[model samples]
Target chain A: MVRQERALRTREALIESAATVFDRDGFSVASLAAISSLAGVSNGALHFHFSNKAGVADAVEQAASERLERLVAAHGEAVGSALQMLVDTSHRLARRLGEDVVLRAGFELSRDHVRQGGRDLYRQWHAWVEEALKRAEGEGALNGIAPEQVASSVVAATTGFEVLGARDPKWLSRRTVTRFWQLLLPQLATPPVLGSLVAAGGPPGDHARRTPGGSPAARAGEEDD
Target chain B: MVRQERALRTREALIESAATVFDRDGFSVASLAAISSLAGVSNGALHFHFSNKAGVADAVEQAASERLERLVAAHGEAVGSALQMLVDTSHRLARRLGEDVVLRAGFELSRDHVRQGGRDLYRQWHAWVEEALKRAEGEGALNGIAPEQVASSVVAATTGFEVLGARDPKWLSRRTVTRFWQLLLPQLATPPVLGSLVAAGGPPGDHARRTPGGSPAARAGEEDD
Candidate 1:
């Protein structure tokens, strides 16, 4: 059991290494050597954990997804309302991923999974978004559109926005989310009564102690972008 | 003068080569040798045109930007309503780039450019969106919200939906475009003035018979994703 646990730890290390390399530089630039270097493992040991780069990528996706699932549950449970929970959770989740290059690397894994004909993890997330939209509808929180269409659009919009956020921190942060709430709030049946729409600090913070715009990692620690 | 013209042709060849290479294998994986070979030019000649890989990328960005500028004007002039024009043009543009890896590569380039610097090339497009919203508001076509906020939200939502279309062809189609119109129509300035919105087919295909989707060079013609 001890040996197996150690082996598992080593595997996790390699994945983190791979994710960092992939996220900082795109997949093509991410080399096995760099991955192993980041993990502080011998190249041979890295290979021992994963036979190929694709295997490493798969592990990264699963790990990131697991973390996201845990975050959703934890934050969801803590909040007073589901809608508030989602907004706060999105803020927190984006912060976490923005801070850690490995988590951001998960996006690449997602793209690769589609190219490789693997299980669509994005579809799984889409289902979750749909389920949430359905609940919102039941609570009279949605516009006239069907939950199916709205949910799919939300999923796409959210992911697309995230990609845009990753690329254009200034335009997106300076305007994107603020604009998002404008259009979306009207669509919702009711705005969450709990929490102010504009929260200060930690992504929602000011430039004195925090900035809403910067590289993902830097902004992760500051105000909401 | 002949040498100058030859130089211009060589530059064009290099830019086209960069687009093709970037389209097939993505930006980073594409090698200079591959680009040079595609251009059917010697390595020295390729270097003469573009000082480095970055130079090639810069050239591509300029060319793509010019093309996009033409597109922005084309839609603005051909269609009277800015709001309807954006959607209609989006559908057509999606088709234009759907199969042409070159156009897609252009999208990829501008995204990266925005990431590296806060240049305002694309910002102009957002400004136009804002202008449309305010005009709609003045005409009493807007919901109860600030026009600037509403316009920003609409643009973000539209863009958010666009990312979906790029990843999954089925997300945006003639039927889907109609659906989008239906959803946004109510939000418009007096029911979108129905006569103003044009259908998928434009100008009756009298010029060069360019297919609705794919590059003009495609063999089998265009097909929806």
Candidate 2:
């Protein structure tokens, strides 16, 4: 049992290291030797866990997808209007993306045309956004627009944030996501629903507590008009 | 004058050929030899025109930007509300993206991390969207929302469409762009202004006639709802 746990730890380390390398250098230029070296693992151990660079990328993508799934599931469990859930989830996602290199790298890899055959994080997120909007429509949270139309815009905007955030990290900042919702929510939700929704999300420290040593300070103090 | 004209034609052919190869194979795997061969020019000729592959890519990006500039300028010439101008320009740009390989490849290359120091097409589009929204606000066409906020979402959504369309061409279709405006225009335009706006854009073949041998036929028949 102890040996198995150690193996798992090593694998996790390697995945984290690979994500950092991939995030910084991109998939085409990132090297396995650099990844293993960063992880402080032997070349043999790296091979044992991942057969090749593609394997490492696949592992990173899988790890990121699992986190994304958890994020969606967590927001879904909360009792609220689906529209508010969508807003809150987007905020949380932007924050998590800022703090987690693995998640960010996974999203980046999903769009990298050079890489092949991995989970498409954007598509998965788009599916979730679509489902949420459909639920909101059933609840009459939406004004009169079709749920699918809103889904396309939401997915596109959020995916755009991710892509733009890669170069300018500020694109993933809370102020940016909140500003987007502030503009969109008023148009999307009915009068009552709009009043009930929090475009700025739950609270500053709502999800920050979950990530130990995660600095919320870096994300604060932006003029949010 | 004949020599200069011939030189211009050769340069244009090389840029067109490079865009085709880059679109199909991506920038990393695309080769100068293949580009020249596809252009039916000797490699010595390719070298004469471009110092290297990056030079070729720069030319493609420049040509694409010029086409985009012309599309924007053409729309700006028509006397209309700034909001409608924004809508029409978006439609024309989407159609151009679908038919024009150089334009499409230029957008793809803009987001490519491997390439460096070229005009950012998204930023240029975003700036234009911002200016138009500001103009609409001045015209009292916008319903109290800050133009900058709307601009951010619009830019993100449009950029998202461009990025998503890379994999699935449907995202860049007139129908898809029209659907986006249908959802957004109502929320964006003031009540008096909304009635005058056309979400489906000017007319079929309005700008499609400009592209020689272009097929608007392939783009037709998608359900608008």
- lDDT string for model 2 (B78-131, tens) is 646898788878878877887899998998888777789478887788888899
DockQ of candidates 1 onward, in order? 0.22, 0.43
**What range of 10 consecutive residues in model 2 chain B has the weakest lDDT sum?**
B212-221
Interface RMSD, every prediction, one decimal place? 5.3, 2.6
* Residue pairs whose backbone atoms clash in candidate 1: A141-A189, A142-A189, A201-A205, A203-A222, A203-A223, A203-A224, A204-A223, A204-A224, A205-A223
What's the TM-score of each model vs. the native? 0.72, 0.89
Write the residue-wise lDDT of candidate 1 on B1-225 in tens digits: 999999899888888889888766666677899999998999999988888776787777677666656655665455445555555555555555555555555656555522242233345546666766675566555544465655554544445544555567765544444334434443343444534444333344312333354222211111222
Report how far off residue B224 is in candidate 1 (Å).
17
Q: Name the runs in model 1 displaced over 4 angstroms.
A: A1-3, A71-96, A112-121, A134-144, A170-175, A185-225, B1-10, B39-45, B77-80, B113-124, B131-144, B151-166, B175-225
lDDT of each: 0.56, 0.80
Q: What is the TM-score of chain A in candidate 1?
A: 0.75
Q: Which predicted model would earn the best DockQ?
A: 2
Candidate 2, B199: how far from true, in Å?
A: 1.6
Q: Considering the true interface contacts (CA pairs under 8 Å between chains A and B), give the fraction that model 2 also has.
A: 0.47
Candidate 1 has an fnat equal to 0.28
Question: Which 10-residue window in model 1 chain A sums to the lowest lDDT?
Answer: A215-224
Query: How large an RMSD does model 2 have?
Result: 5.0
